[model samples]
Target: MRTAQPRHYLMCRPTHFDVVYSINPWMDPRKPVDTPLAIAQWESLRQTYLSLGHTVETIDPLPGLPDMVFAANGATVIDGRALVARFRDAERIAEGPAYLQWLREHGFADARTASIVNEGEGDYLLAGEWLLAGTGFRSDPRSHAEAQEFFGRPVIGLTLVDPDYYHLDTALSVLDEKTVAYYPAAFSPGSLAVLQRLFPDAIIATDADASVFGLNAASDGYNVVLPHNATHLIEALRERGFNPIGADMSELLKAGGSVKCCTLELRSAG
Candidate 1:
C-alpha cells in the first residue's frame, strides 16, 4: 500500500540492542543495553513516527547490527533511483538485499549501489541538485567521484571525523526545501563552506548538540526526536521554529543511533 503523501519512510525493530559491542579499537561500549529496554525504546520512537501521520512499515529486528533500522544509510532513493551504499563495516554488509527488492517491487527502473564500503546514512546528504556524501569515518573518500560518475550529478563529499557522525544525515537535515539543520564539525570544512554558500538560511545547530546525534533527529516535515531531557536543545529548536517532539531513544542510543537512524523516508519509489 502506498502512502497518501509523496514520501514514505521505513524502519526496523531492534532484537539485540545490548548485543552491540562497539569497541576493540576505541569506540565506547557502555555495557550492553538490556533487550527489553531496547524493544520499549524502539516502540516509543516508532510511535512518534506514527503520530506524525506517516505510513510506518515495521520490519523484524536483526541481531548483531542494531543499526539496521536506518536503511537509508545503506541505500538512498531519489528521482526513482536506488543508490545502494557500500558499507564500511562487515556487520552491515548484507543489509542491501531488502532495499533492492523494495526498489524492484516499487517500480523503480534504475537502481544501483555504490562500489565503496561506506554503509552510513549520515555520510550521505541529499540536497538541491546534488547529493552531498560524507567521507572519513565510514565512507571511503573515493566514493564521491564514483557517485558523481554513476548518477550524473555532482556528488560533493562531506568531511567525516568520528563514528558518531559517520553519515551526512547525522550532521545535516532538511527542515524544508530551503532550510536545513547542520553541524559543520561533522562535515569537511570544504563541504561546510560550500553548504553555507548554497544554503545560507539553513539552520546550523551548535556542535555540542551535534554530539548528541540529534541534529539528524528530524522528519515527517514537522517533528524531531530529541534526546530525553534535552530541554535546552528542544527549546532552542522550537525557537528556530521546529516542533520538537519527544522519544525516549536511550536504548537506540546505546547502539549509537537516534530517531533519524531508526527510519527511512521512502520518497516517490514509483
Candidate 2:
C-alpha cells in the first residue's frame, strides 16, 4: 500500500493569467481568458494541497508575466539547492531571474540560474536517485549534464517527440521514488526503450487521457491529483492503490498546464 507524505510546495497565483501570445499547441491568443476563473481554479489546487497536509508557499505574481501561475517551470529545488530555469522562449526570459531572486531571498543560498536553456522542473523530475531530464522542445540537451553536476544525481535524458507534450512534466509524472505514469507515444523510440528498461511496471496512460493533460498530475506518494477529464487515468491510478483526486484545470489547460504545472515541490535535504 502507498503511504502519503507531507510535501512543501511553491506556487504563484494566477493574478494576471491570460494568453496574449501562443507558445505551445494549447495556447491561442484569440481564445477568451477569464482571469478570475483562473484564479479560482488555482486556489482550488492550492487548497487541495493544504487539505492534504502539504505546505504551500506563494511568490507574488508579476503583472506582465501571465504564465507565472505555472510555477513548476520556475526552478528545480532539491536538497535545498535550486537551479533556476533559463527559458527557451524570449517571452519567458525574465522568469529566470525572477525565480533566481526568489530562491536567493527565500533561504536557498545555493541557488543559481541555469547557464543553458532549461525550463526548471518542467523538464527535470526526480525519481528515486535518478534525475529524469527531458529535451526536444523547451529544454536544451546540454542542460541535462548541468543538472547532473548540480544535483549530483545520475541524469537520464529523455527525448520528447510530441509538440503537445512540450515539457516532460506534461507527458510524465513521477508517482513515487520507484514508479511513474506516462504516455509512451509522447517519447521517442529510444527514450521509450529506456523507460521500459527502467520502469517495467509503470502505469501507461491512453491518448484520450494524455490529450487532456492527464500525465501532468502531481503525486504525494499516495494521492494523485490530475485533471477531472482524464477519466481513464483516474481509474488506472485507483487500480494501482492510489487515491486519485480529480481537479478542474480547464482554464489553466488553455495555456498548456494543469496540476503539476502549478505546483513546484520543494525537496529539502535530510
Candidate 3:
C-alpha cells in the first residue's frame, strides 16, 4: 500500500446534547455543564473552517459515546479504505461501529475491531508503509501490530513519554504535502529519528504551543487548525508560509479532544 494522508477531514456539528457532560439532561455525565465558552468556540471553529473554503458537515443528533467528537479516533481511512476502529475506552467504542455503518451504506468495504482493546484513532497515523502509532497510554502495542496487519502496512510504533502528549494528534500532524508538525520530546528517540527522516523540513513545535492548542491539530495541505488566541504560534506558522486557521474547540478539549479529533478524512486523504 502507499502512504495515505487526509486531504480533508469530516467535522461534525455539536449541540447541547452532543457535548460530553453537556447541558442536556438526557446524556449522562459529570453533571450539567456550564460550557458557554466551549459553545462559542465551536461556532468560531465552524466559521474559521468555512473561511478556508471548506464545507463543514454537521453530524446533527450526535450519537453514543461520551467523547465522540474524535471521529478520527474511531475510523481509519486508507485510500478511502475504511476500517472502523475499536476503542479501548468503553465510552467511545460505539463510535467505531457507527462509522463502519456509514461506510457500508456508502458502498465501501469496511473492517471491524477484533475486541474491545484497540485505543483511540488519534494514537495512530498511516505514514507510508509504516503505521506510526503511539504504543503507550491510550493505544497499546498489542493492537498496534494488529492494526498493521489488518491494513497490510508495517508498524512504526512510538511510545508516548508523558500524559499531555498522550495522543498522536497532540504531537504530530502532516502540515502540508511535504512538511509535518511534531514535538520530538514526546516521542522515543527512535520514533523521533523516523519522523525526521520522513519529513526532513518538519516544524518542531515548542512545548508551550503543544499544550496551548495541540501543535499538530489538523491540516489541509498548507492550512492548519489551531485554537483561539494562538497569536504567537500563528505568527510562526505564517512565517513558515502556512495558513494557521483557528477553530473553537473548548468543549472538545474539556472532553480531551479538539479539531483534530473531530474528523477523519476518507477517500484520497493524501
Candidate 4:
C-alpha cells in the first residue's frame, strides 16, 4: 500500500481574480471571468489538502495582481530555504518582491529573491534529490545554475516547447519522491529523452488530458489531486494504486493555472 506523507503548502485566495491581460496561450482577456466561482474552487482545493492531513499557509492577496492567486509562481521552498521568483513578464515583476517579503517575515529566514528570471515553482519542481528546472518560455536557462546553488541540489534543465504549457507545473507533476506524470508533447526532443531516461516508469498523459491541465496536479505520495475531466489519468492513477482526487479549477484555467499552479510546497530539512 502506498502511504501518504502529510505536506506543507502555501496558497493565496483569489479575492481579486480577473483575466485582464494575456501572458500565455491559456489567457484570453476577451473571455468573461467569474471571480466568485474562482474563489469557491480555490477554497475547495485548500480544503482538499486539509482533509488529506496537510498543513496550509496563506499570504495576503495584493490587488491588481490577478495572477498572484497562482501562488506556485511565488517561490520554491526547499529545506526551509526560499528562492523567490523573478518573473519574466513585466506584468508580474512586482510579485517576486511581494513573495520574498512574505517569506522573510513568516519564518523563512533564508528566503531571497532570484537574480535571474525564474518563475518560482512554476519552472522549478523538486522530485526526490533532483530539481527539475524548466526553460524556453517564462524562465531563463541561467536560473538553473542559480537554483542549484541556492538549493544545493542537482538541477536538470528541461525545455518546454508548447506555449500552452509554458510552466513546468502545467506540463508535469511530481507524484511522489520517484514517480511523475507528464505530457510528452509539451517538452522538446532533448527534454523528452531526459525525462524517459530519468523516470522510466513515469505516467504519460494523452493530449486530451494534458489539454485540460490535468498534469497540473499535486500528490502526497498516495492521493493525487487533479482535474476531474482527466478521466484517462484518473484511471491510470487508480491502476497504480494511487487515490486520485478530482478538483474543478475550470474558472482558474482562464488564467492559465490549476491545482499545482495554486499550490506551493514548503519543504524543510529532514
Model 3 C-alpha lDDT per residue in residues 1-270, reported as the tens digit of each score: 123223545655554424444321223455444456655666676677677676565543255544555567766777656566776655566666766676666556555654435554587776545567776667667877677667777777777776677778777776655667788788888878888887887877777777665564666666778765556667777788877777656555656667777766664433
**How many angstroms is residue 226 displaced in model 2 relative to the true structure, after the best TM-score fit?**
0.6
Q: What does candidate 2's lDDT look like per residue over 122-209, in tens digits? A: 9999999999999999999999999999999999999999999999999999999999999999999999999999999999999999
Global fold similarity of model 2 (TM-score) = 0.99
Looking at model 2, residue 59 earns an lDDT score of 92
Model 1 worst lDDT window (10 residues): 1-10
Q: Write one digit per residue (lDDT tens) for candidate 1, span 1-270.
A: 111222466777777555345621223565655768777877887776677677776555555565566655657666556677667666677676656666566676677767776554556666666777877677788877776776667787768665566667777776655567777776667777888898887766775667666675754445666665555567766776667786777666655677777766655633
RMSD of each: 3.8, 0.6, 5.0, 0.7
TM-score of 3: 0.80
Alpha-carbon runs more than 4 Å astray in model 1? 1-6, 23-30, 105-109, 149-152
Q: Which scores better on TM-score, 2 or 3? A: 2
lDDT ranking, high to low: 4, 2, 1, 3
TM-score, model 1 to reference: 0.84
TM-score of each: 0.84, 0.99, 0.80, 0.99
Compute the lDDT for candidate 1: 0.65
**lDDT score, residue 134, model 4?**
95
| Cα error, candidate 1, residue 183 (Å) | 2.0
Candidate 4 or 1, higher lDDT: 4
Between prediction 3 and prediction 4, the one with superior TM-score is: 4
